[model samples]
Target: MSFYKKDNSDYLEQAFYSLQGQTLPADEIILIQDGQVGADLENIVKKWSQRLPIRLFVNRENIGLGMSLKKGLELCSYEFVARMDSDDICHPERFEHQYNFLKSHPEIAVVGSWIAEFSETIEKISNYRKLPSDSEELFFFAKKRCPLNHPTVMYRKSDINKVGSYFNFRFQQDYHLWGRLLNSGFRIANIPKSLVYMRVDERLFNRRGGIRYFQIETQVQKTFLDIGFINKLEFIRNYIIRGCIRLIPNSLRKNFYETFLR
Candidate 1:
Protein backbone atom coordinates (compact mmCIF):
# COMPACT_ATOMS: atom_id res chain seq x y z
CA MET A 1 0.00 0.00 0.00
CA SER A 2 1.09 3.60 -0.80
CA PHE A 3 -0.41 7.07 -0.49
CA TYR A 4 0.33 10.31 -2.31
CA LYS A 5 -1.25 13.77 -2.30
CA LYS A 6 0.64 15.99 -4.72
CA ASP A 7 2.95 16.14 -7.72
CA ASN A 8 5.56 13.47 -7.10
CA SER A 9 6.00 11.96 -10.52
CA ASP A 10 9.71 11.21 -10.19
CA TYR A 11 9.32 9.57 -6.78
CA LEU A 12 6.24 7.64 -7.89
CA GLU A 13 8.03 6.35 -10.94
CA GLN A 14 11.02 5.21 -8.89
CA ALA A 15 8.76 3.60 -6.30
CA PHE A 16 6.94 1.63 -8.97
CA TYR A 17 10.17 0.64 -10.63
CA SER A 18 11.56 -0.61 -7.32
CA LEU A 19 8.39 -2.56 -6.55
CA GLN A 20 8.20 -4.21 -9.97
CA GLY A 21 11.91 -4.90 -9.90
CA GLN A 22 11.77 -6.69 -6.54
CA THR A 23 13.13 -10.22 -6.46
CA LEU A 24 9.82 -11.41 -5.04
CA PRO A 25 7.71 -8.78 -6.75
CA ALA A 26 4.47 -7.61 -5.17
CA ASP A 27 1.46 -9.57 -6.46
CA GLU A 28 -0.61 -6.41 -6.35
CA ILE A 29 0.00 -2.74 -5.64
CA ILE A 30 -2.75 -0.65 -4.06
CA LEU A 31 -2.01 3.02 -4.70
CA ILE A 32 -4.27 5.50 -2.94
CA GLN A 33 -4.55 9.06 -4.14
CA ASP A 34 -5.54 10.77 -0.89
CA GLY A 35 -7.03 13.60 -2.93
CA GLN A 36 -6.83 14.99 -6.43
CA VAL A 37 -3.19 15.23 -7.51
CA GLY A 38 -1.22 16.81 -10.33
CA ALA A 39 -1.55 15.67 -13.91
CA ASP A 40 2.05 14.49 -13.90
CA LEU A 41 1.42 12.20 -10.94
CA GLU A 42 -1.81 10.94 -12.56
CA ASN A 43 -0.02 10.23 -15.81
CA ILE A 44 2.74 8.35 -14.03
CA VAL A 45 0.18 6.19 -12.21
CA LYS A 46 -1.68 5.60 -15.45
CA LYS A 47 1.52 4.45 -17.12
CA TRP A 48 2.35 2.06 -14.28
CA SER A 49 -1.23 0.72 -14.17
CA GLN A 50 -0.78 -0.63 -17.69
CA ARG A 51 2.49 -2.35 -16.80
CA LEU A 52 1.81 -3.50 -13.22
CA PRO A 53 -1.02 -5.08 -11.24
CA ILE A 54 -1.93 -1.81 -9.54
CA ARG A 55 -5.39 -1.02 -8.17
CA LEU A 56 -5.87 2.73 -7.87
CA PHE A 57 -8.27 4.35 -5.41
CA VAL A 58 -8.80 8.07 -5.85
CA ASN A 59 -10.42 9.90 -2.96
CA ARG A 60 -12.44 12.90 -4.04
CA GLU A 61 -11.19 14.89 -1.05
CA ASN A 62 -8.08 14.63 1.07
CA ILE A 63 -8.54 11.95 3.74
CA GLY A 64 -5.06 11.87 5.32
CA LEU A 65 -2.68 8.90 5.54
CA GLY A 66 -4.47 6.85 8.16
CA MET A 67 -7.82 6.90 6.34
CA SER A 68 -6.15 6.31 3.02
CA LEU A 69 -4.39 3.23 4.40
CA LYS A 70 -7.56 2.03 6.11
CA LYS A 71 -9.36 2.14 2.77
CA GLY A 72 -6.47 0.40 1.03
CA LEU A 73 -6.51 -2.41 3.60
CA GLU A 74 -10.12 -3.18 2.76
CA LEU A 75 -9.20 -3.77 -0.88
CA CYS A 76 -6.18 -5.98 -0.24
CA SER A 77 -6.68 -9.57 -1.44
CA TYR A 78 -3.63 -11.07 0.25
CA GLU A 79 -3.00 -12.10 3.85
CA PHE A 80 0.15 -9.97 4.25
CA VAL A 81 0.40 -6.39 3.04
CA ALA A 82 3.61 -4.41 2.75
CA ARG A 83 3.42 -0.67 3.39
CA MET A 84 5.38 1.86 1.37
CA ASP A 85 5.55 5.62 1.11
CA SER A 86 5.28 7.52 -2.19
CA ASP A 87 8.84 8.81 -1.99
CA ASP A 88 10.62 5.82 -0.50
CA ILE A 89 12.47 3.13 -2.44
CA CYS A 90 12.51 -0.51 -1.43
CA HIS A 91 15.47 -2.78 -1.92
CA PRO A 92 15.30 -5.35 -4.69
CA GLU A 93 15.17 -8.20 -2.16
CA ARG A 94 12.92 -6.46 0.36
CA PHE A 95 9.75 -8.39 -0.41
CA GLU A 96 11.62 -11.68 -0.72
CA HIS A 97 13.29 -11.26 2.66
CA GLN A 98 10.17 -10.04 4.45
CA TYR A 99 7.88 -12.69 2.92
CA ASN A 100 10.27 -15.49 3.80
CA PHE A 101 10.56 -14.18 7.36
CA LEU A 102 6.81 -14.00 7.81
CA LYS A 103 6.33 -17.44 6.25
CA SER A 104 8.86 -18.90 8.66
CA HIS A 105 7.65 -17.01 11.70
CA PRO A 106 3.94 -17.50 11.91
CA GLU A 107 3.75 -16.18 15.45
CA ILE A 108 4.68 -12.65 14.37
CA ALA A 109 1.85 -10.35 13.31
CA VAL A 110 3.92 -7.50 11.90
CA VAL A 111 7.50 -7.29 10.67
CA GLY A 112 9.51 -4.20 9.71
CA SER A 113 13.11 -3.47 8.81
CA TRP A 114 15.66 -0.77 9.46
CA ILE A 115 15.76 2.06 6.95
CA ALA A 116 18.58 4.17 5.53
CA GLU A 117 17.69 7.84 5.62
CA PHE A 118 18.88 9.88 2.68
CA SER A 119 18.36 13.35 1.22
CA GLU A 120 18.91 13.16 -2.52
CA THR A 121 20.31 9.72 -3.33
CA ILE A 122 20.42 6.33 -1.64
CA GLU A 123 24.19 6.25 -1.80
CA LYS A 124 24.36 9.42 0.30
CA ILE A 125 22.58 8.03 3.33
CA SER A 126 22.76 10.65 6.10
CA ASN A 127 21.43 8.51 8.91
CA TYR A 128 19.96 5.12 9.75
CA ARG A 129 16.76 4.34 11.61
CA LYS A 130 17.22 1.09 13.49
CA LEU A 131 14.56 -0.77 15.45
CA PRO A 132 14.20 -3.52 18.03
CA SER A 133 13.94 -7.06 16.69
CA ASP A 134 11.98 -8.74 19.48
CA SER A 135 8.50 -8.29 20.86
CA GLU A 136 9.54 -7.49 24.43
CA GLU A 137 12.03 -4.85 23.37
CA LEU A 138 9.58 -3.46 20.87
CA PHE A 139 6.88 -3.15 23.52
CA PHE A 140 9.18 -1.15 25.74
CA PHE A 141 10.53 0.87 22.82
CA ALA A 142 7.04 1.83 21.67
CA LYS A 143 6.45 3.62 24.97
CA LYS A 144 8.96 6.32 24.00
CA ARG A 145 9.47 6.03 20.26
CA CYS A 146 7.87 4.38 17.28
CA PRO A 147 9.13 0.79 17.28
CA LEU A 148 8.42 0.00 13.64
CA ASN A 149 9.38 1.97 10.58
CA HIS A 150 5.89 2.44 9.12
CA PRO A 151 6.83 2.51 5.46
CA THR A 152 9.01 -0.58 5.80
CA VAL A 153 6.47 -2.78 7.54
CA MET A 154 4.81 -5.97 6.26
CA TYR A 155 1.87 -6.83 8.45
CA ARG A 156 -0.82 -9.49 8.54
CA LYS A 157 -4.14 -8.05 7.43
CA SER A 158 -6.18 -10.31 9.73
CA ASP A 159 -4.13 -9.26 12.73
CA ILE A 160 -4.50 -5.58 11.86
CA ASN A 161 -8.27 -5.98 11.48
CA LYS A 162 -8.49 -7.86 14.77
CA VAL A 163 -6.78 -5.02 16.61
CA GLY A 164 -8.87 -2.45 14.69
CA SER A 165 -7.68 -0.97 11.45
CA TYR A 166 -5.73 2.29 11.15
CA PHE A 167 -7.24 5.19 13.02
CA ASN A 168 -8.08 8.61 11.57
CA PHE A 169 -4.99 10.26 13.01
CA ARG A 170 -3.01 13.15 11.57
CA PHE A 171 0.32 12.07 12.99
CA GLN A 172 1.95 9.06 14.61
CA GLN A 173 -0.86 6.82 13.38
CA ASP A 174 1.49 3.88 12.83
CA TYR A 175 2.85 4.22 16.34
CA HIS A 176 -0.66 4.33 17.76
CA LEU A 177 -1.72 1.28 15.74
CA TRP A 178 1.29 -0.71 16.93
CA GLY A 179 0.41 0.12 20.51
CA ARG A 180 -3.11 -1.17 19.96
CA LEU A 181 -1.80 -4.37 18.39
CA LEU A 182 0.65 -4.96 21.19
CA ASN A 183 -2.05 -4.46 23.80
CA SER A 184 -4.20 -6.93 21.87
CA GLY A 185 -1.47 -9.60 22.14
CA PHE A 186 0.02 -9.39 18.65
CA ARG A 187 3.76 -9.91 18.23
CA ILE A 188 5.95 -7.48 16.31
CA ALA A 189 9.55 -7.69 15.13
CA ASN A 190 12.01 -6.06 12.78
CA ILE A 191 14.68 -7.33 10.39
CA PRO A 192 18.13 -6.16 11.47
CA LYS A 193 19.11 -4.91 8.02
CA SER A 194 17.95 -1.80 6.25
CA LEU A 195 15.54 -2.83 3.52
CA VAL A 196 14.34 0.57 2.37
CA TYR A 197 15.74 3.97 1.48
CA MET A 198 13.78 6.61 3.39
CA ARG A 199 13.80 10.19 2.18
CA VAL A 200 14.45 12.62 5.01
CA ASP A 201 15.32 16.28 4.61
CA GLU A 202 15.07 19.55 6.51
CA ARG A 203 11.34 19.77 5.92
CA LEU A 204 10.80 16.45 7.70
CA PHE A 205 12.81 17.63 10.68
CA ASN A 206 10.88 20.89 10.84
CA ARG A 207 7.52 19.14 10.63
CA ARG A 208 8.40 16.78 13.44
CA GLY A 209 9.25 19.55 15.93
CA GLY A 210 6.40 22.06 15.52
CA ILE A 211 3.55 22.76 17.93
CA ARG A 212 0.98 21.08 15.67
CA TYR A 213 2.99 17.87 15.62
CA PHE A 214 3.48 18.03 19.37
CA GLN A 215 -0.26 18.31 19.89
CA ILE A 216 -0.84 15.14 17.91
CA GLU A 217 2.01 13.42 19.75
CA THR A 218 0.51 14.26 23.11
CA GLN A 219 -2.89 13.01 21.98
CA VAL A 220 -1.45 9.68 20.90
CA GLN A 221 0.36 9.30 24.22
CA LYS A 222 -2.87 10.02 26.07
CA THR A 223 -4.72 7.39 24.04
CA PHE A 224 -2.07 4.83 24.92
CA LEU A 225 -2.43 5.71 28.57
CA ASP A 226 -6.21 5.43 28.44
CA ILE A 227 -6.02 2.04 26.71
CA GLY A 228 -3.78 0.67 29.52
CA PHE A 229 -0.89 0.19 27.15
CA ILE A 230 1.11 2.71 29.20
CA ASN A 231 0.93 3.69 32.85
CA LYS A 232 0.75 7.24 34.22
CA LEU A 233 4.45 7.37 34.97
CA GLU A 234 5.34 6.17 31.50
CA PHE A 235 3.02 8.71 29.98
CA ILE A 236 4.51 11.59 31.92
CA ARG A 237 8.05 10.50 31.15
CA ASN A 238 7.27 10.14 27.48
CA TYR A 239 5.64 13.54 27.36
CA ILE A 240 8.57 15.24 29.05
CA ILE A 241 11.21 13.57 26.88
CA ARG A 242 9.35 13.90 23.60
CA GLY A 243 8.11 17.40 24.39
CA CYS A 244 11.61 18.62 25.14
CA ILE A 245 12.90 17.14 21.90
CA ARG A 246 10.21 18.85 19.94
CA LEU A 247 10.90 22.17 21.64
CA ILE A 248 14.48 22.30 20.44
CA PRO A 249 15.55 24.11 17.29
CA ASN A 250 15.23 22.13 14.09
CA SER A 251 18.96 21.87 13.49
CA LEU A 252 19.58 20.71 17.03
CA ARG A 253 16.58 18.41 16.82
CA LYS A 254 17.89 16.83 13.66
CA ASN A 255 21.29 16.31 15.17
CA PHE A 256 19.76 14.88 18.34
CA TYR A 257 17.61 12.52 16.34
CA GLU A 258 20.46 11.32 14.18
CA THR A 259 22.88 11.03 17.09
CA PHE A 260 20.62 9.67 19.81
CA LEU A 261 17.18 8.55 18.66
CA ARG A 262 18.34 6.64 15.60
Candidate 2:
Protein backbone atom coordinates (compact mmCIF):
# COMPACT_ATOMS: atom_id res chain seq x y z
CA MET A 1 0.00 0.00 0.00
CA SER A 2 1.21 3.50 -0.88
CA PHE A 3 0.09 7.10 -0.82
CA TYR A 4 0.93 9.19 -3.88
CA LYS A 5 0.18 12.54 -5.42
CA LYS A 6 -0.10 13.65 -9.03
CA ASP A 7 2.45 15.68 -11.07
CA ASN A 8 4.94 12.86 -10.68
CA SER A 9 4.08 10.73 -13.66
CA ASP A 10 7.61 9.91 -14.75
CA TYR A 11 8.71 8.93 -11.29
CA LEU A 12 5.60 6.84 -10.93
CA GLU A 13 6.64 4.96 -14.05
CA GLN A 14 10.04 4.25 -12.55
CA ALA A 15 8.37 3.07 -9.33
CA PHE A 16 6.10 0.70 -11.22
CA TYR A 17 8.99 -0.62 -13.23
CA SER A 18 10.93 -1.34 -10.08
CA LEU A 19 7.98 -3.13 -8.52
CA GLN A 20 7.48 -5.19 -11.65
CA GLY A 21 11.15 -6.08 -11.71
CA GLN A 22 11.02 -7.33 -8.14
CA THR A 23 11.49 -11.05 -7.62
CA LEU A 24 8.30 -11.05 -5.61
CA PRO A 25 6.06 -8.42 -7.07
CA ALA A 26 3.23 -7.10 -4.96
CA ASP A 27 0.15 -9.25 -5.19
CA GLU A 28 -1.96 -6.14 -5.05
CA ILE A 29 -0.81 -2.55 -5.32
CA ILE A 30 -3.04 -0.15 -3.46
CA LEU A 31 -2.36 3.47 -4.36
CA ILE A 32 -4.05 6.18 -2.30
CA GLN A 33 -4.57 9.24 -4.46
CA ASP A 34 -5.14 12.25 -2.21
CA GLY A 35 -7.53 13.81 -4.69
CA GLN A 36 -8.07 14.29 -8.38
CA VAL A 37 -5.77 17.19 -9.16
CA GLY A 38 -6.01 17.17 -12.97
CA ALA A 39 -3.20 14.61 -12.97
CA ASP A 40 -4.35 11.53 -14.78
CA LEU A 41 -3.06 8.88 -12.40
CA GLU A 42 -6.11 6.78 -13.09
CA ASN A 43 -5.20 6.47 -16.73
CA ILE A 44 -1.68 5.41 -15.87
CA VAL A 45 -2.97 2.92 -13.37
CA LYS A 46 -5.35 1.59 -15.98
CA LYS A 47 -2.50 0.97 -18.39
CA TRP A 48 -0.47 -0.82 -15.74
CA SER A 49 -3.40 -2.69 -14.19
CA GLN A 50 -3.59 -5.08 -17.12
CA ARG A 51 -0.29 -6.64 -16.09
CA LEU A 52 -0.57 -6.27 -12.33
CA PRO A 53 -3.51 -5.78 -10.02
CA ILE A 54 -3.71 -2.08 -9.13
CA ARG A 55 -6.34 -0.78 -6.79
CA LEU A 56 -6.56 2.96 -6.42
CA PHE A 57 -8.30 4.58 -3.47
CA VAL A 58 -9.27 7.97 -4.80
CA ASN A 59 -10.32 10.46 -2.15
CA ARG A 60 -13.06 12.88 -2.99
CA GLU A 61 -11.68 15.23 -0.36
CA ASN A 62 -8.02 16.07 -0.05
CA ILE A 63 -6.79 14.10 2.93
CA GLY A 64 -3.33 14.61 4.35
CA LEU A 65 -0.53 12.07 3.78
CA GLY A 66 -0.64 10.67 7.31
CA MET A 67 -4.34 9.90 7.09
CA SER A 68 -3.93 8.44 3.65
CA LEU A 69 -1.22 6.06 4.86
CA LYS A 70 -3.27 4.98 7.85
CA LYS A 71 -6.25 4.35 5.61
CA GLY A 72 -4.07 2.24 3.31
CA LEU A 73 -2.74 0.22 6.23
CA GLU A 74 -6.24 -0.41 7.44
CA LEU A 75 -7.29 -1.60 4.00
CA CYS A 76 -4.25 -3.68 3.07
CA SER A 77 -4.81 -7.43 2.88
CA TYR A 78 -1.18 -8.38 3.32
CA GLU A 79 0.67 -9.31 6.49
CA PHE A 80 3.61 -7.08 5.60
CA VAL A 81 3.50 -3.55 4.15
CA ALA A 82 6.18 -1.97 2.01
CA ARG A 83 6.13 1.77 1.54
CA MET A 84 6.96 3.63 -1.67
CA ASP A 85 6.71 7.25 -2.66
CA SER A 86 5.26 8.55 -5.89
CA ASP A 87 8.54 10.15 -6.96
CA ASP A 88 11.16 7.59 -5.95
CA ILE A 89 12.76 4.64 -7.68
CA CYS A 90 12.97 1.40 -5.74
CA HIS A 91 15.63 -1.19 -6.42
CA PRO A 92 14.56 -4.31 -8.23
CA GLU A 93 15.57 -6.55 -5.35
CA ARG A 94 14.15 -4.27 -2.66
CA PHE A 95 11.12 -6.44 -1.97
CA GLU A 96 12.93 -9.76 -2.10
CA HIS A 97 15.81 -8.54 0.02
CA GLN A 98 13.65 -6.93 2.71
CA TYR A 99 11.18 -9.79 2.79
CA ASN A 100 13.95 -12.35 3.28
CA PHE A 101 15.70 -10.23 5.90
CA LEU A 102 12.48 -9.78 7.84
CA LYS A 103 11.78 -13.46 7.70
CA SER A 104 15.20 -14.28 9.10
CA HIS A 105 14.99 -11.63 11.80
CA PRO A 106 11.49 -11.77 13.11
CA GLU A 107 12.24 -9.50 16.07
CA ILE A 108 12.47 -6.38 13.92
CA ALA A 109 9.27 -4.41 13.50
CA VAL A 110 10.53 -2.26 10.65
CA VAL A 111 13.36 -2.39 8.11
CA GLY A 112 14.68 0.42 5.89
CA SER A 113 17.58 1.00 3.53
CA TRP A 114 20.01 3.63 2.31
CA ILE A 115 18.98 5.98 -0.49
CA ALA A 116 20.63 8.21 -3.07
CA GLU A 117 19.16 11.68 -3.29
CA PHE A 118 19.32 13.39 -6.68
CA SER A 119 18.52 16.94 -7.54
CA GLU A 120 15.83 17.64 -10.12
CA THR A 121 18.58 19.09 -12.27
CA ILE A 122 19.95 15.51 -12.46
CA GLU A 123 22.90 16.00 -10.12
CA LYS A 124 23.42 13.66 -7.21
CA ILE A 125 23.87 16.22 -4.48
CA SER A 126 23.38 14.07 -1.37
CA ASN A 127 22.94 10.57 -0.15
CA TYR A 128 21.11 9.19 2.90
CA ARG A 129 22.77 5.87 3.63
CA LYS A 130 22.19 4.21 7.00
CA LEU A 131 24.70 2.73 9.40
CA PRO A 132 25.94 -0.87 9.09
CA SER A 133 23.66 -2.64 11.61
CA ASP A 134 22.47 -2.49 15.20
CA SER A 135 18.97 -1.68 16.31
CA GLU A 136 20.23 0.42 19.18
CA GLU A 137 22.53 2.39 16.92
CA LEU A 138 19.69 2.98 14.50
CA PHE A 139 17.54 4.23 17.38
CA PHE A 140 20.25 6.68 18.43
CA PHE A 141 20.67 7.83 14.83
CA ALA A 142 16.96 8.75 14.74
CA LYS A 143 17.16 11.11 17.71
CA LYS A 144 17.88 14.15 15.54
CA ARG A 145 16.19 13.22 12.28
CA CYS A 146 14.52 10.30 10.59
CA PRO A 147 17.18 7.66 10.24
CA LEU A 148 14.97 5.50 8.09
CA ASN A 149 14.05 6.70 4.63
CA HIS A 150 10.28 6.52 4.26
CA PRO A 151 10.36 5.22 0.69
CA THR A 152 12.61 2.32 1.67
CA VAL A 153 10.68 1.04 4.67
CA MET A 154 8.98 -2.35 4.89
CA TYR A 155 7.28 -3.26 8.13
CA ARG A 156 5.12 -5.84 9.77
CA LYS A 157 1.47 -4.88 9.51
CA SER A 158 0.70 -6.23 12.97
CA ASP A 159 3.56 -4.29 14.53
CA ILE A 160 2.18 -1.03 13.19
CA ASN A 161 -1.24 -1.88 14.60
CA LYS A 162 0.34 -2.68 17.97
CA VAL A 163 1.58 0.90 18.10
CA GLY A 164 -1.94 2.17 17.29
CA SER A 165 -1.11 2.88 13.64
CA TYR A 166 -0.05 6.22 12.17
CA PHE A 167 -0.74 9.45 14.03
CA ASN A 168 -3.62 11.43 12.72
CA PHE A 169 -2.97 14.82 11.07
CA ARG A 170 0.70 14.92 12.00
CA PHE A 171 2.88 16.80 9.52
CA GLN A 172 6.03 14.80 10.32
CA GLN A 173 4.00 11.70 10.88
CA ASP A 174 6.82 9.34 9.93
CA TYR A 175 9.22 10.75 12.51
CA HIS A 176 6.56 10.97 15.21
CA LEU A 177 5.37 7.48 14.39
CA TRP A 178 8.91 6.14 14.64
CA GLY A 179 9.30 7.66 18.10
CA ARG A 180 6.07 6.05 19.21
CA LEU A 181 7.11 2.71 17.80
CA LEU A 182 10.48 2.78 19.57
CA ASN A 183 8.88 3.88 22.82
CA SER A 184 6.50 0.95 22.52
CA GLY A 185 9.47 -1.47 22.48
CA PHE A 186 9.51 -2.03 18.74
CA ARG A 187 12.89 -2.45 17.05
CA ILE A 188 14.05 -0.97 13.76
CA ALA A 189 16.72 -2.39 11.49
CA ASN A 190 18.39 -1.21 8.31
CA ILE A 191 19.91 -3.17 5.46
CA PRO A 192 23.32 -1.83 4.47
CA LYS A 193 22.31 -1.38 0.87
CA SER A 194 21.00 1.40 -1.30
CA LEU A 195 17.46 0.38 -2.26
CA VAL A 196 15.92 3.62 -3.38
CA TYR A 197 16.72 6.71 -5.41
CA MET A 198 15.17 9.75 -3.76
CA ARG A 199 14.50 12.85 -5.80
CA VAL A 200 14.84 16.24 -4.15
CA ASP A 201 12.30 18.73 -5.35
CA GLU A 202 13.83 22.07 -6.36
CA ARG A 203 11.47 24.03 -4.13
CA LEU A 204 12.82 22.30 -1.02
CA PHE A 205 16.04 24.36 -1.33
CA ASN A 206 14.15 27.56 -0.35
CA ARG A 207 12.59 29.08 2.75
CA ARG A 208 9.69 26.67 2.62
CA GLY A 209 12.16 23.81 3.00
CA GLY A 210 13.56 25.33 6.17
CA ILE A 211 10.07 25.81 7.58
CA ARG A 212 9.07 22.25 6.81
CA TYR A 213 12.21 20.85 8.39
CA PHE A 214 11.73 23.03 11.46
CA GLN A 215 8.17 21.78 11.87
CA ILE A 216 9.33 18.16 11.58
CA GLU A 217 12.09 18.70 14.12
CA THR A 218 9.73 20.41 16.56
CA GLN A 219 7.27 17.56 16.38
CA VAL A 220 10.05 15.02 16.73
CA GLN A 221 11.41 16.71 19.84
CA LYS A 222 7.93 16.95 21.31
CA THR A 223 7.46 13.21 20.83
CA PHE A 224 10.72 12.47 22.63
CA LEU A 225 9.73 14.78 25.48
CA ASP A 226 6.28 13.25 25.81
CA ILE A 227 7.79 9.77 25.88
CA GLY A 228 10.41 10.81 28.44
CA PHE A 229 13.18 9.74 26.12
CA ILE A 230 15.10 12.98 26.69
CA ASN A 231 14.99 15.96 29.01
CA LYS A 232 14.80 19.54 27.81
CA LEU A 233 18.55 20.09 27.88
CA GLU A 234 19.31 16.91 25.98
CA PHE A 235 16.72 17.78 23.36
CA ILE A 236 18.21 21.22 22.92
CA ARG A 237 21.71 19.78 22.61
CA ASN A 238 20.66 17.32 19.97
CA TYR A 239 18.69 19.94 18.09
CA ILE A 240 21.66 22.27 17.90
CA ILE A 241 24.29 19.68 17.10
CA ARG A 242 22.29 17.87 14.45
CA GLY A 243 21.04 20.94 12.63
CA CYS A 244 24.31 22.87 12.89
CA ILE A 245 25.47 21.58 9.51
CA ARG A 246 22.46 23.00 7.75
CA LEU A 247 23.45 26.43 9.05
CA ILE A 248 26.61 26.41 6.98
CA PRO A 249 26.77 27.59 3.38
CA ASN A 250 24.76 25.36 1.07
CA SER A 251 27.70 24.27 -1.06
CA LEU A 252 29.75 23.21 1.92
CA ARG A 253 26.78 21.61 3.61
CA LYS A 254 25.93 19.67 0.50
CA ASN A 255 29.47 18.39 0.06
CA PHE A 256 29.94 17.46 3.72
CA TYR A 257 26.53 15.91 4.11
CA GLU A 258 26.86 13.80 0.99
CA THR A 259 30.50 12.77 1.34
CA PHE A 260 30.80 12.05 5.06
CA LEU A 261 27.47 11.61 6.79
CA ARG A 262 25.89 9.64 3.99
Predicted candidate 2 versus true structure: per-residue lDDT over 135-242, tens digit per residue: 998777777566677778999999998888887534567877787888788999889888887776434433223545665666678778878766798798867754
How many clashes show up in model 2? Answer: 0
Candidate 1 lDDT tens digits, 1-262? 5555563789888988898889998889988888878778888999999989999988989888999899999999999899999889999999999999999999999999999999889999988899889888998888878999999999999999998899977878899899999988889999999999988888888988978888889999999999999999999999998899888999999898888978
lDDT of each: 0.90, 0.75
What are the RMSDs of all candidates, in order?
1.0, 3.0
| Clash numbers, per candidate | 0, 0
**Which model scores highest in TM-score?**
1
State every prediction's TM-score relative to the real structure: 0.97, 0.86
| Minimal lDDT window, size 10, model 2 | 202-211
